[model samples]
Target: MNEVANPGSSAVVLIGTAEYDHADVERVPSVSANLDDLYDALLDPGIWGVPAENITVLRDERDPASVYDAIRAAARSTRDDGLFLVYYAGHGFPYDDDLVLGLREVDPQFPDEKGLRYPKIRQATQLAIALRRVVILDCCFAGRAGREVLDAGDAVKQIAGRAEISAEETYLLVAVGPNELAKAPLNDRHTAFTSALLHVLTTGSETADPVLSIRTVAEKVIRRVVAAGHRRPEFRAANAAVDAPLVRNARLRPHDLTGVVLEATADVTDPELRGAVILVLRHNDSGALGVRLNRDFGPLPAALDGWRDHVSLPDRLFDGGPVAQDGFISLVRLREHEERPIRFTEVTGLLGSLPLSDAQQSARDRIADLRIFRGYLGWRPGALERLVTHGRLRITDTNPFHAAFARAPFTRTGS
Candidate 1:
């Protein structure tokens, strides 16, 4: 399950330098817009709803010490379970192998001395008591922060072992790789990466979970950035923090049961579907596809006898639905720590569908769970939504594994 950071206790610091003093470094007028749009996105009720009081915005800051002070205060103020977020959009001055944040007074000739060094930002974040921390960089060579901050196993740097800055709770979203430059078109309203991020936050993603995880947002942002022929962005998060909820999804509502469990309502008169437990394999604007979990379709077909022994509990072909009864759909859960295998379309988490032929003999040891279903339920684009809205099907939070393996029984219940 994805945990939502407590908005009231969380803190956000957004710093943007739209104007610079150095003659060599160009000013980014769009940076001011970036801060505004992100501030609005963070406060959107449908998104995170973080209180305005908890957020601080600094534009064209003249003093690097003030920036450090803001980060320090926010980090110290956030509670243990809250999230601490810091965002910087401006000129990134490369100092040796480290990246520095350019302020209004930054001197390109002496970047390390005039700019806010990465180590200062690291030290402030390391002092935070918050359980989860996020740092977003939208400047040239932003990815260098990843090498400096996220490589927790760095032997030379003993500070990387700090608890607050550990890999388990820290996440980095950089606009470009260490060698690439972030795009800031003069006429554009925001930098390329920030524009993509704001768009995803406001519009939300149809394929993501009900709550928007940072990882999901990063995936969409990276795709958009790459599609526009801009520098590719990078995302780094370790452990469960990868799936932590950054905000409520603006697109997928609770009634949209894509990759979710659905049980028939008790009052349903359809004998074939009543008391049915189903796992929706796919739901989109086109339609929905689901497989019945509890209904028994007798033993495995003779042609698929080879899979009978490898299937999970309740090893039998299931009466998936009325559509294409001759066809088969196989769901497999890959073992923990295993990378997604080829020829698999992930449904949710580690659960995914595998072609019968592909799973016949390969990577058998990596299979943690498996289920085979005959046929599947189908609904036109709006049909399933109407059914859900009218209470014919009850959306459930049941773990997908239970439905995949038929580990639990669904009773004829209320909507």
Candidate 2:
């Protein structure tokens, strides 16, 4: 049985730099431009389902030196409470049995000679020695980076001999096998391995094992990659005798509440809802309460969809649950200092409720123009708290920009 684990206990490092000065390997236009996308995806509050303070992201454009230092810090730190994830996306080159991750200026001809250097697998294993590490390498030849360090006899002996290990443990999940090449599909705009990995982790396709173990996530990623037209990715387990849980053990139990009503049953209709923050709504016979947020809703439009007649709200309504597919409701928050005459019920200081107007034509227009949802998330008062206590549900605090508006709804051209 999979055990529930706390997400707050971990730290994540995202390093991506594609501006290689010397190389025929077409500098992945998407890698450099989509650095923020990769960063945002990892740092997404919804992904962690935990508080912002618990997660930290180090990217190339923001701080280059700190990226390496952060990895070293994680390696040295002794925190057995949370999991640690390190994601690297860019060019990867194999050196004999070992692999080297290229930084921004890595020259294909001279990997070690040029640009910043870090032992992709060795450094990750060093960090895993102390914490539960889920190292995701999205670059080519990533599989070879950690092979040597993990296979070291001394390291294996030290971990294997231990009699008792905690449920919270460390592991690694690489994108491809050491011998195989990792390729991103042109249509998906993401590496085949990565796309499959994300799908299994978030799509709830593997819901039977909600707290995914290293073995399980690895198997799913490998299968998905191969099925998607790529070579089989590899799965390596270190210190298996330790019996550490791969994914944190947790469960997000369903909540039963009479407050709000949802409009949709399936998540397919709203592609935006996938891997996004949303507001769920539930309707009672008399009225309804729109769950302020079902997931982590991203950015809001700078201006309302159609603000000519009345100053519109800044948020877009999204499908929150699998219930009503056509019903629409919204929770609008006034600007920090700006006050309006509209009457509303306060869900929280930062969130308020506004009912759909009675006018049929106006209501239809509002629903069509704005991003409205059919259903919402319904949580009985204590149910959410219970899930949090059991490590099932995580409430994330995110900035409006980072949550929704920062990146384009669609991937940038090259990405």
Candidate 3:
């Protein structure tokens, strides 16, 4: 995922169980899907800001202590900056005035000690070196996690239902009320609650609000679930210095785009798009198009290695875009040899599109930088210019060869 513009140190711990080895715990068919969706959402380059490498996922953990240990270590690891978030989607129950996350091996009769208490989580959140600590619990009767955050002394005996805990910088979201059941309805692929969460995170709707915070997320989720006639979602925030921003809305910039010669500006938020330089093959009022310069999509197929015989650069494919993913095309950087066929359009000095026939002919001369692209990016008439006007793209002249593979398309202004 793309790091926040000024994203501080961050860590994510995700735990979910779809089945339990113990017969006492009924399998929660949707927990696995919940984890899958959440993992992707947090890694969304345009939204959650949590990097894939910085995340830890425990799926159907057989060891009861491992999740807690990992969480403890993660809390310790995040010690004073960025955000630390823990997400749990599985079986859990209220215990001794607190909610305890259930282990996969949990024995119903001995369930009391088969998990960790919410107080332990609160303690970890407090001690975590991060600026913000977020706990998301998606399980039956799981709302106590929020209530206990505000008033730990109260023995939360029933569906602790969502507590309206006040906080300076509060962040906690629970799935159902104390007596309520979090349903993974047979008709749906994901639990109603988790599906609601995903919708708020990935929706394309425009919002004047700049920041997507826990408060805002809770509100959106509540609206979605209540409208569906499911149990209401709950949220509680303790004292906080500011309402933490989870993601910044994608905005466009106002600038002219020459297509090939332009850089993505501050307003672009297309995942790994901003600051990426692209090789523009076509551009005009009718439309504009290009492929990323720096995307090295692993090594090229063995047959294509012959095309790279002349250049010392690595032979790899570049992911052009998300459009035509099933098809493949080659962007050849030829040596402009006399023996080379003139059937392709030159994109830059020595670089152009290479036909499959010539590409397979074993060029009589060496090729410099030959790249295979899975797809290409395109824009409709006047759309490319509109993007620039809204700041989605920036214009700049750069050495097509070096910029395409060696450096950041543009120097970043912030994290």
lDDT of all predictions: 0.78, 0.49, 0.65
Weakest lDDT window of 10 consecutive positions for candidate 3 = 150-159
The candidate 2 region of ten consecutive residues with least summed lDDT is 256-265
Give the number of colliding residue pairs in candidate 1: 0
**Per-residue lDDT value at 290 in model 2:** 37
- Candidate numbers sorted by lDDT from highest down: 1, 3, 2
Best by lDDT: 1
Best by TM-score: 3
Per-residue lDDT tens digits for candidate 1, residues 125-192, read: 86778878888999998888857444323322444454553444777889998878899977999998
- The positional error of residue 129 in candidate 1, measured at the CA in angstroms, is 1.5
Residue 5 in model 1: lDDT: 79
Return whichever of 2 and 3 wins on TM-score. 3
Error of 1 at 364 (Å): 74
Please give the lDDT score at residue 158 for candidate 1.
49
Off by over 4 Å in 1: 148-168, 238-242, 253-415
Instruction: Residues 265-299, candidate 2: write the lDDT tens digits.
Output: 23323343233343323323333333323342334
Better of 1 and 3 by TM-score: 3
Q: In the order shown, what is each candidate's alpha-carbon RMSD?
A: 16.1, 15.5, 11.9
Q: Residue 198 error for model 2, in Å?
A: 1.2
